[model samples]
Target: MSYTIKPWQDLTIQDDYMFKLVMRRKPICKRMLEKILHVPIRDIRYSDDEKTMKFQYEGKGIRLDVYVADDKGTVYDIEMQVRKPSDDGLYLRTRYYQSMIDMGLLEEGADYDELNPSYIIFICPFEPFDKGRHIYTFRNVCLEDTSLELRDGATKIFLSSVGTADDVTPDVKRFLEYVNGILSNDAFVQEIDQEIKRVKKLEEERVRYMTYAMKMQEERKEGIKEGREAMQHEMQHDLALKMLKDHKPIHEIVRYTELTENQIRKIAAENSNVSFGEESGRNV
Candidate 1:
């Protein structure tokens, strides 16, 4: 027996679709973020550029998909990824984004006197770290002595997908399960079904536009081909007439002629300046 292996395509998450679902569940995520970071979220602003919000963790460059700021000048770099990442991979990405955010604190001529707190949140569909069932939070600490603590800088929060739903809040669990695309039970499924419907509608609209664009591209290619064929035919016809005027032999003309026999005969009659039987039929 043979099994077919399918190629994996990157999951395409449209900005509008993501925003709609995320905005709907913003309160839940915000609450969770505040709880995990122990920071008060003065305000949450959704980015206007959808492309920026859709950046993947595996991609190059440092970009914070969702950025949050509090009244205390703390910045939160919030990201949503659909796949599980390794420890090295996780820390590398987190540190990259954190460093970029930290660099923004000191301007060209400004002083590094005041630095705000920055938090990086990785909300994944699968668990990336070992933190048991509930949400896991991490912060900088004294690794050598284990007594000293660096509490002013960056932090990381991982939203795990494993374990029973009873471990987390009802709203948070519902939101997580929805993000994971796992509607195991009826009640949870029903709650997420409405949001799923909205996403589907947006997907359908995107498909329609893609279909129209493809059709237009194909039509344009066909038109160009037709025009080229027509020009080629006219050029061949002119070449054949010139050859006939040179009094080329019939056998040689047949070998090299771009014209049909009837076309050659018409040229021959016109060059001879004689009225054939069908002369009055149509002007040659």
Candidate 2:
């Protein structure tokens, strides 16, 4: 196993776990919503903070940064999204988050109208849309009639760290700059920095951070191991398919391709007749 040392002193606002911890504080979180949202937000309360949400056991889950609500019953899922231009799944991800949030809002038999007004705000450290606009807000709208509105009571906002436009308020821009790792003199940003420093000074938080880093490393290694195993499985299946097409015996296919006899038979059964001038065996 290889090791890489992380710089402790330079840990910035973009660090996912650290940012999550900082946002769990009510004052900091309330100020953040007020600044970026440009609204007089009432008292903020977190029912659950950074809760790992999943559809099923053993399924991939997302660790939400700040899951809180205002006094008026408006649910907010503030996410500090780690930027990745390579993954094109974020748009659907927001949709999924919105659905999950709504599902958890009310009792099982409650009417749909009982759902709270929800916001899934994603703070992306990288410019997502490649536009210069700092903030992008979306809601359901009618495409047939320009004047018609869906008014679904759900809002999805995306905040980009690298945006240069004046679409957002100056305070919002300052917060974005702080999230982008630029040193800031803004009062709210300074408060965030101070809280981060205090959190770092805590013996408990420090120990947790160390353990979190070790867990992250292990997860990374496990992910690499899973990827390699998947690749090898795919290769073996591909070879089994070719051998099946050539009418190779199952025992020989199993010996040479590392596939079980049942698997090889199943693959052959799926694609035994090559009528359309195609390979007779399925790759999977």
Best by TM-score: 2
**What TM-score against the true fold does each predicted structure earn?**
0.51, 0.86
Task: After the best TM-score superposition of candidate 2, give how far the Cα of residue 57 lies from its true spot, in angstroms.
Answer: 4.5
lDDT tens digits, residue span 16-40, model 1: 2343344345564466566555557
Q: What would the per-residue lDDT of candidate 2 be over residues 1-284, giving only the tens digit for each residue?
A: 66554545556678777888888788998988888777898798887655666676766677677898899988889888886646678888898888777666654354697777889999998878888889999888888986887877899999998988878877788888888777679888889999989888887877787788889889889988998998999999888888766666566788888877788777766885511112334333
Tell me which residue pairs clash in candidate 1: none
Model 2 CA deviation exceeding 4 Å by range? 1-5, 103-113, 272-284
Off by over 4 Å in 1: 1-21, 24-32, 35-42, 46-60, 107-110, 144-147, 164-170, 183-196, 199-284
Alpha carbon lDDT of residue 21, candidate 2?
84
